[model samples]
Target: MRALIVRHEHVTEPGLVGDRLAEHGYRLTTVTVVPEPRHHAPDVPFDFPDAADWDLIVSLGAPWSVYDHAAVGSWIDGELALLRKAHHLGVPVLGVCFGAQALTTALGGSVEAAPRPEIGWTEIETDLPALVPPGPWFQWHYDRCVLPPGAVELARNAVCTQAFRVGRSLGVQFHPEITTAMVRGWLGLGGAEQCVRHGVDPHALLAHSRAMEADARANTRLLVDGFLEQVANTTA
Candidate 1:
């Protein structure tokens, strides 16, 4: 199987998710939207690949919100079109954070600023243990997605929707793809400053991530397996 991974920025790579995809024999083709050296620049041009060639599409997290179309320029619209096309074709998609927001928008929902930004590790309530675990998922977002049309709400907490599923596509608000190295990169790249601005202690965030690395990786692996097995195509 082939999976197209849409990497929005330098920091948020596929991480453990890519590892699991490889384990499942899914070859990954990553399309880095804003490569290094120009990653922080706003309104950079984004070139997306044709989604039909891939068996699955995985959209990773990003610092930008889906509603920031003006700042993101035409790329946001292009991505939304891709999401819609993939869905219509019954091609499975898994979206995280900003990707989830994009999925929501593509499915006729909206994204907006949350009541409060979520940073660091947080728990989400879920009955779908086959897909999502109950505790300690990485989160770093100021936006929340409204449940899209025909979507099933799979998980939630006081702060956000957490996750939802529309047919074979899943949109998760939290980060299950974060590895220790990925977390460290995020913290080192002005993420600490953003946390401080949000009244979050960067030190504590790092400590929490360090403590949860083992459990997080295990949970992420399970989620990845579930996504590929239950959400993607199967030959009967």
Candidate 2:
């Protein structure tokens, strides 16, 4: 099988998620939308590949909001089109954080600023724990996804809807692909300051990530298995 990973920026990589997919016998192809140099001016022109080419599509998180067209420009529209096409083609999609917001928008929902940003590791309220575990998943977003029509909400919290499913697509508002190295990269790129503003100690957050490395990996493996067996393979 083949999996197409959409990395919104240069820093965030397909960590544990990609590992799980690989273990399940998938060849991974990654595409980066915003290069490191274009970090500030993210409204760059880009092309998204055809969704029909890949067996599965995974869209990673971004620091930007899906509704902020002024920041993302036409690329947001293009990604939405790609996701919509993927859905129509019966292609399975795993959308994380900003990607979840994008999926929600593409499926007739909307994205908006959350009451407060969810930073650091947090647990959610899940209706489908076997698939969407009520985990202490990593979260770093200022926006939330409103459920699209015909979407089954899988999980939520006091802040926002954590996970939802529509057709063969699953959208999770948390980071299951997190790694210590990824956390360090985010911190190097002003993420530390963002955490500080939100009353989260960046240093402690890093420590927590390092300490829970094994547990996080195990949880991610379960999540990937559930996505494939219960959601993606159901249609296949």
Candidate 3:
């Protein structure tokens, strides 16, 4: 099997999810959507590959908001079109964070700025624990997905909706693919400043991530397995 990973930025990698996919004998083909110089968010022109070519599509997170069309409307428009096409073609999609918001928008839902941003590790309430596990999951988003019509909400919390499923697609607001290295990279790219503004201690967040590294890996593996067996294979 093959997985097409849609990385929104250079710093946002597949991390543990990619590792699990590789272990399951899936070849990864990564496409970086925005490859602009430096870590500054920019509106760059790019094209997604043919969605029919890959067995699965994994859309990674981004620093930008999905609702900010005026800023990233050009590429986000193409991304939404591609995601809709992929969904129509019955391709299984795993959308994380901004990708989840993109998926929701692509599937007749809406994305908006959250009342309160979730920055650190937080626990969620899950209706489908086997599919969407309860956390202590990593979160770093200012927006929230309102969920598409016909979508089954799998998880949520006081702040926002956490995870949902529509047809062959699954969207999770939290980052199960997070890793210490990825967090470090994000921190270097002004994430620390954002954390400070949000009243979050960057060092404490990093420490928590380091402590949960092993558990996070195991949980991510379980999530991948569940997605493959339940969401992907069932639809196939």
Cα TM-score per model: 0.95, 0.98, 0.96
Task: Evaluate model 2: give its lDDT.
Answer: 0.92
State the displacement of the C-alpha of residue 45, model 3, in Å, after optimal TM-score superposition.
0.8
Over 1-236, each residue of candidate 3 has an lDDT whose tens digit, in order, gives: 88999998898889999999988888999999878493365688888888889899999999998888766758898889889999999999999999999999999999988999999899899998888889789999999998889999889999889988888888999999999999999999999999999999999999999999998998888788888888777432
**How should the candidates be ordered by lDDT, best one leading?**
2, 3, 1
Off by over 4 Å in 3: 36-38, 234-236
Order of models, best TM-score first: 2, 3, 1
Regions of candidate 1 where Cα sits further than 4 Å from its true position: 233-236
TM-score for model 2? 0.98
- On residues 36-121, what C-alpha lDDT tens digit does candidate 2 reach at each position? 99998899999999999989999999989898889988999989999999999999999999988989999899998899999889
User: lDDT score, residue 165, model 2?
Assistant: 92
Candidate number achieving the greatest TM-score relative to the actual structure? 2
Model 2 has a clash total of: 0
RMSD for each of the candidates: 1.5, 1.2, 1.4
